[model samples]
Target: MTSIPNVTLNNGIEMPQLGFGVFQVPDDETTAAVATALEAGYRSIDTAAIYGNERGVGRAIAESGIARDELFVTTKLWNEDQGHDATLAAFDASLDKLGLDYVDLYLIHWPAPARDRYLDTWRAFEKILGEGRVRAIGVSNFQVAHLERLMENTGVTPAVNQVELHPGLQQEELRAFHERHGIATEAWSPLAQGAVLGDQAVADLAARYGVSPAQVVLRWHLQIGNIVIPKSVTPERVRQNLDVFGFELTDEDLRSLAALDRGLRTGPDPDTFN
Candidate 1:
């Protein structure tokens, strides 16, 4: 089994720096995919209610015989479930679907500024945290302004902020802000959904390291201190993704990758995605 390093959240909970994500994986295939990841020594699994595969994730966890405490499970609340009452109800539904009494971390899937319910929804998250149903709470797809407002109006600061980040969209300013505020930056599309794999710099580094382009990217993510969850349904790719802890990228190589950032976004804009 591979020993994945743990990133301690602001709340003192330790999460695997690299995890497996089931973003586009269908429900039926999710179980086998998750099982493959687990067998490959992955302890953290990222899923969302919106992904509609929490049940599949749960099934894999149940059958793995891997003790619950040994695994870290994360699921998100959907955009429609943004209000306080609705958020709580939706969380219960997610817990039910996951077949777990408590989740390692729960996040608001998006800020959804137009709805203006995240503040209210976060209060419910705090409530859930207080009851010990969740180890930590956080938000996803939140911009700087949204994070500032959330901290100002709320009693608890988010432990992690999951977002679409890749070599093409480095998010330097946002990551700096997270560092200042002690929030862990978790990247969803850490590889740019295969968009960054074709870059000359990435390929050169991959060749130098004798590894795949995806491993180079994933290594870059870890070296830069981002908790990355790379999704792959293929068993070989799933194992390959976890094999990124062996090498380290030097400062020059990092700069080369940094220069590749063109502010490319592969997902919806958080500021306007109401």
Candidate 2:
């Protein structure tokens, strides 16, 4: 079993540092893929309403017969679903599809600065939190400006901020900001969406630890205190991702990995995506 420790959220929830992500996972194949992940001992499943696979993921969990309390399920509100009432309706729809009364984490999918309604959306999230329908609430792809505005306006801080973090795009400044605000940083594309898998540095680290490149990347995220949710369809790779508990990365190895951070990104910049 992986020896990674669970990181406590601002709300006192202990979530596994490494989770299973289903970003591009299709609806038809979502169930089997999630079932495989559950069998592989993944306690956390990260999905989104935009992914259009919530039902499949829910079915997998229901069929697994694993008690709801034993799992941590996270989903996000799409860009089109912003504001107080719209967000509540969206949350209910997502919950209905997932077959859960409450979610472990619910995030604003994007800042959508142009829409200028995340503050309102967050207010709705707080409402849900107060009702105890959701264990934790958060944001995703949020820049510093967005976070600051939210803090200034709502006077509520999110439990986590899921971002596009990988060895290539370190986002050190944002991570520091999250640390200052007591918000955990969760990495969405932890593998750079497969862009850094073949890098010589990652390859060398994998060779040193007798693990796959993915394992080395996931381990690096763990060392940096960032929760990582790596996505995969193949059973072998999914299993390989979770078996990163034994070895420890040396200081020298970590320094080398830091040098690999080129600030490159495979996803659209949230600041201008809208």
Candidate 3:
């Protein structure tokens, strides 16, 4: 089993740096896929209400025999659930689907800036945290301006900000802002949906390190201090994703990977998305 390292969030919560993501994973396959990830030594699992697999995730956790305290589970509030009242109701629904008394972390899945209700949503998150319904609260796809406004309005800092991040879309500015605010930057689609696996630079690094291109890319994310969740339905790949801790990428290799950033994103723009 690979020993995954933990990153402490601003609120003093320790989350596994490497986690298994369930994005785009079909509902029917989520349970088995999540089970494979757990069996492969992944203690952290990231899912959401919009993902439509929280029930399957709950089923896997219920059957995995792993104690609740030993696992870190995360879910999110959807765009339609952006106001304080709706956010609380949505969280309750998510929890009902997840069959958990409390989640390790909860997030606003997207800023949906146009709706302009994220502030209200965040207030609910703060209340949930205060009530001990969640260990930590955060946001996703939040840009610098959104985070700043959120902090200003609510006077509470998000523990994390998850976004589409990979070698191709480094999000340097947002990442720096997160660093300055003591918030952890977590990477969704960390592999860029396999877009970077065939890159010449990553291929070369993989060859040198005797690892797969996916491993090289995941290692790069870790070296750069990004909490990354690489999802895979294949059992072998699930195990393979957790096998990145054994090797180290050199400074030169890190630079080469950094140079691959093209500022491209595989998901919606946070500022514009509703």
Per-residue lDDT of candidate 1, residues 123-175 (tens digit): 99999999999999999999999999999999999999999999999999999
Residue 61 C-alpha lDDT in model 3: 99
Q: What lDDT would each prediction earn against the true structure?
A: 0.97, 0.93, 0.94
Best by TM-score: 1
Off by over 4 Å in 3: none
Higher TM-score: candidate 1 or 2? 1
Residues 1-274 of candidate 2: C-alpha lDDT, one tens digit per residue? 4454789998898888989999898988999999999999998999999999999999999999999998999999998999999999999999999999899999999999889889999999999999999999999999999999999999569999999999999999999999999999999999998888899989999998899998999999999899999999999998989998888898899998899899888888999876
Higher-lDDT candidate of 1 and 3: 1
Residue 153 lDDT (model 2): 92
TM-score of each: 0.99, 0.98, 0.99
RMSD of each: 0.5, 0.9, 0.7
Prediction 3 TM-score vs. true: 0.99
**What would the TM-score be for candidate 2 when compared with the true structure?**
0.98
**Per-residue lDDT of candidate 3, residues 1-274 (tens digit):** 6789999999888999999999888889999999999999999999999999999999999999999999999999999989999999999999999999999999999999889999999999999999999999999999899999999989679999999999999999999999988999999999898898899999998999899999999999999999999999999999999999889999999999989999878888888999
On lDDT, who's better, 2 or 3? 3
